[model samples]
Target: MKTSISKAVAPVAFVLALAFTLLLHGAVPFWGTPTLGQAVWTTGFSHSFVNHGLLPYAYDFGAPAPASIAFGLAGAYPAALLIALGMHPADAYAAMVALWLTVAFVSAWWLGIRAGAGSVKSTLAALAWVTMPVIWAHSGYSMLSTGIALLPFYSLAACMLFLDDVQGSRKIGRALLYLSSCLISVFMDGYSFMMFAMGSSIVAAYSFVMNHSTRRRLLTYSLPVHIAGFSLAYVLFALYIGKPSFGAAPLDFFRGWGADVTFFLFPTQGIHWMWDTLGLSVPRSHRELFGDSSVWKTTYLAPLLIAGLLGWLFTFSKSRIASAALIIAVAGLYLSLGPSLKFNSLVPQEIIETGVNMQHMPAELAIAPTGSALLSEHLPGFKNMRASYRWVALAAFGLWFLLLLWLSKAETLGARSAAAILCLAVIGSNLPHPQRYLEIPASNRAQFKAIDTMLVDDMREALQPGEQIAFLPYRNDFLVNYLAPSVPIRTYNIGGDKNLAMARENWPKTMRQFKMNKVDPAFADRLLWLLAQGEADAVVLPYIDMLWAAHAWPGGKIHQKQVQPAIDRLSATGLVDIDTREYYAVVRLNATARVLGQTALQAKLRQTLCLPGFCVRQAASSNAIHSRVGRLSANTLKSDGRRGFLVFGPYEPVESGTYLLVVWGRAPVPAGAWVDIVSSRGSTVHAKFSVPRTASRPDNILLEEKVVFDEAVDDLEVRIFAEEGSRIAITGYELRLARSGPDKD
Candidate 1:
């Protein structure tokens, strides 16, 4: 009767555990918040899977395939199928998380049963493993980390290969299972694969060392099968991903992610409040030692779970599985400390002040570096192993596995009660608040849909084949910015600064045309030129200020003061603002305007003239004064005094030509103030005009002069000679080359 009851309880417990796991993760069937950060990248992968087949080369605005070889189609294909079935991407993602958690729980139970636990005990163990804090945290951030779902099953297969006595068909089956699990883990996530491989190596090494017969068995039976498995997986990975590239990173990159020793002893963030009242609180400084330090939050094990681990260590220390778990846990903890030993709040000030100086060390100790640095520097693949805190997952797994192993040996009522309590404690400790998963706002969703309709759908329908579009003030997050546009159009300004750099290098003519001395012309010119060159059919300038304000947490007002100048300058060019919405402006280059041969056309220049107290003076070699078309004016203008003359140019015509020069001036001029066009060859005044003080509208004055040059003279100057008390301003000028021909000498 007791046996039947226990059997009945196991299945019920498993079901309850699955439901609880979903509830804990907020992955309750069809409803849950979206995972943030790296999850966006995963959604992109799914998008690619839906649009193209598996192993797609490009997606997300044509960004090069993102680590897809390692990431495989494990989660992507399923999400894509759900999306095809009319589930929203967010809903589909939540479903995938649920499926991953279910697999993980079942795999844990299978491993426990393989390790000799009874049905009821293994079910409890599975529940404990599913609610582990590290798994929960990883699930919320990186979906790829869900590859840990396979770790337990793989560990079970490794045990059969290394420790168990199996023969013939069973041995072959175990070998095949081990190989498949390894391949699956590798495809699921590279980091999880590393953790599994490391633990397996340690277990295998221990087995080989224990006896000569075992070493021979490993050499003959295990090594060959594992090698073949690894080789096949590698060949497939290489074919899919091409050659892997490794880049060197700074020492600080390795150091910053190291786990603190105290993290293991303290309660996790979920239950830290309980510890706070007891005066055993973990320091805030330790919790956030680095930006990625939250990944290290997995170090917490409940007191009861820790007690179970202690019970196992004391009672079954000599057992092969216990020894292997111990070895892996210790090694994982050590490795997770990273390149140097800086234990957050625990490290002494003296040690920090002294720093690490290997130069003065003894010869034997000098060569042997500690922590992950030795492996990262010397090991080929280990250098790429960042986020050392992630190694804590292995340590956590080993401890939990040991706890289950110890619980399996329970026979006395007291021991069984203790095991049950520990299992409950584990679940309680890892129950995260639902708010951890970031909520996607309805307004943000609406905004994205609107942008897709207005920008993407409209542009796709309007543009001719092969025509492209550009987004101004480029953002690095363009993939997320324009996620799932209705029509597929190749986009520019997606590369951020790199795209800007390419524009600067390749589009020099455009750059020159928009170099108006007032502002940074690179942004406006590059965008306009991209359109002018027919590289793009339209330019979408998202009202970035308004967009940011609308998206700001707690809300913010739009401040377009800084970006307004760029918008105004773009408008000043021949690009007409075709559509203006609350969040963006769609502008297109005017087909009729001669944007290409701008240097050969008549150029207009304008400036504000001085009022009563303010005066204007032009520099002798000002490029601003140069006519954009004729290239015969100057721009070097400087303020003279509170009241002074406004002078422009020592103009030099490119060719000997008859020219029409028009000048517009506005000033409060005295009687003696006069405007003169003087020749550089002599002080001969070509034209002069005196201002009358009694003139009703002296501020509104226009002067047009047609000058004939006998030769291509180097210098012709325009000067507003004002009297001492007079204030005259030259508002603007226009220069045009005579239509017929140059005046002959």
Candidate 2:
């Protein structure tokens, strides 16, 4: 029965997985390469800085995410520091490549081993999967940090498919294991699990046709709970953790989703943003548009990928499950395509009631689960993403599995069939249909290094401790947040899809970019006109995104004339420079970072006063208390002087130290006013005093006595009451506070 080969495959796969895990751990385990899509996720990790544990936002900037989510990825920092951090990120990724390869290999071995294939045949299949076209793509370049987790999940799913069971606890245990595995797979990265699910589903359908009794048993125990558990897990994550709400109209729904319907039956139109914030339709052309080249490269590793598809033609006939899996794979593509075809453009049609455009589309609606339940495989990290392409992966895995099943069953067919299969694989490599997307690693990084230096140098020269240079026009969150991680640059806004204040502050140019996306001389002239209105730290202009949508349409001529020229002007007081090196542009911010770096400003003051990176406020103090009194039942200057003080005080100090001075006393029917002060260094040294509030003046406002300066003050004067009454009832009061010294000294 050739059991030796079967035994070797499992251990070989395990060893391979371990090796890849070591690789992915990389040279520097602590400083690992971040996973794909995690660049955005990294931004989400800034929520831990609160005085309290969890806050309403990340970086205190945008809507909050669930706790312990993104923070866990950075755990490597602490994890490496605490435990013997084995692999560097590079090593971890290397391990991941090996891990997935091992998983695919083991899965194939298990497939043949269980199908009565000789141990040798099973091992051969294991080798086949290790070097499979698409799978090889995954091994060469893994994307998820948890790519190592896929192996256990695939093993778990394989057990349910091939093993014949008869018993109470064992059946229950298997079901739980399957369900738990499904949940874990999803959590790793929902998208990948989605692929896993698709491939696994194909195996199930194939089981249904070929092994009817086993299929019935599998269906009886598996279907209901699997569907329920997956749904619940999905909802819990999406609703609570991700917090996805219906976004502004699905505009792309009307466009064709895509013509390549093999991934699922769904149309391709609305797929671009399937799980994104917008959840809208996308262009079909984007199928190969390598937004992130690394991700594309990983997709090519599926061993039985199109180029290698012909290799299985000989085995296809013998493996019913394989054939079914392929058919289901074809069906799964239509899953996404179906929604694209049915995408609901927010625009109301005559058939639908007016004002009630049902915006629910493929993304908003459930499409994959139907096919997913039947043809899905458990992919590690699938839980983290929406179940879109899972069915496809499930079908592919099923076909591959059945191929091994047939290979193992074919002891009588001899070496000819085996040699032919190898020949097909070699030939398949060149046929090429599952082409990998074009990759330009530089595309992942923006060209911001040049201006980063420019910004650093500029702020160093011109900034002062207390003086703040505000960057107008560019989004404070995107520009300032990304740039001023260590600096004290302030912005007027943060984190919104588009910051309105930034736009309004630079209205003339902003409006053109947002709505028109063109360069009009008039618009440009208007912007230049606004620039002269006052001196700003630096006014940033629009970049390409402004015109990427309707708001920034007339971007062409207007950008050239109004936006570009205004940015170029370096009149002595201000300078115009391009921030395009960072992939976006904004006005100059500070005269210099060095100057700003060494300011009199307190870091705490910056947090309390500035919104993340923008200077929306300041602290200043002055002398003079002007008050207004509203008529109460008792009215003017009357009744026991129990009045409210509409007092404005010394703005909070830039340095937040503390001294409390009380302003209290009965307003003499008419007493002369005397203002006194104590030396900051000396006690009770009278700075200035007018005649005690006298009847002759009868001023509208009253100043309290005993204005003591016992300690260094954080705030200015506090309103005090008459010796016997309640709080200061005066209508209005102003407290003048300062560093120290007699006026006119």
TM per candidate: 0.67, 0.44
Query: Once model 1 is optimally superposed onto the true structure by TM-score, how far is the C-alpha of residue 141 displaced, in angstroms?
Result: 2.9
Over the stretch 552-664, how does candidate 1's per-residue lDDT look in tens digits? 32122233344467678777765445565444565676654455344322222111211111112233344445321111224322233334445545453323456566655
Show the lowest summed lDDT stretch of 10 residues, model 1.
Answer: 606-615
What's the CA error at residue 470 for candidate 2, in Å? 11
All models, RMSD in angstroms: 12.7, 16.5
lDDT of 2 by residue, 1-745 (tens): 5566657675665555434333322212223322222221222233122212333222322211123232123222222222223432233332333444455456556656666665455665555444332333332223333432353245446457344465788767766766765665554544445555555565565666677667667677666646655676566545533443212223222112221233222223321222222342233332232112222222221334432243246456665444654564455444423223322223224424443323222333322223332221233332222323222333444445445555554445554486437534522431222212112112211222222354435544443322223333333233333233223333232322322332334333222232233343233333333233332344445443321211112223333334555454433223233345233354443344224432332232233222211111212112233233212323222224334333333323212222123233234432223334333322434334342342223454344332323343333332221222222233333333332222231
Q: Runs in model 2 with CA error above 4 Å? A: 1-105, 116-124, 130-163, 166-168, 188-220, 242-326, 332-395, 413-420, 423-745
- In angstroms, the error of model 2 at 563 is 8.0
Runs of candidate 1 exceeding 4 Å displacement: 63-73, 164-173, 211-213, 268-280, 283-288, 293-296, 302-305, 314-318, 346-369, 434-467, 478-482, 485-488, 492-521, 542-564, 576-578, 593-745
lDDT of 2: 0.36
The model with the greatest TM-score is 1
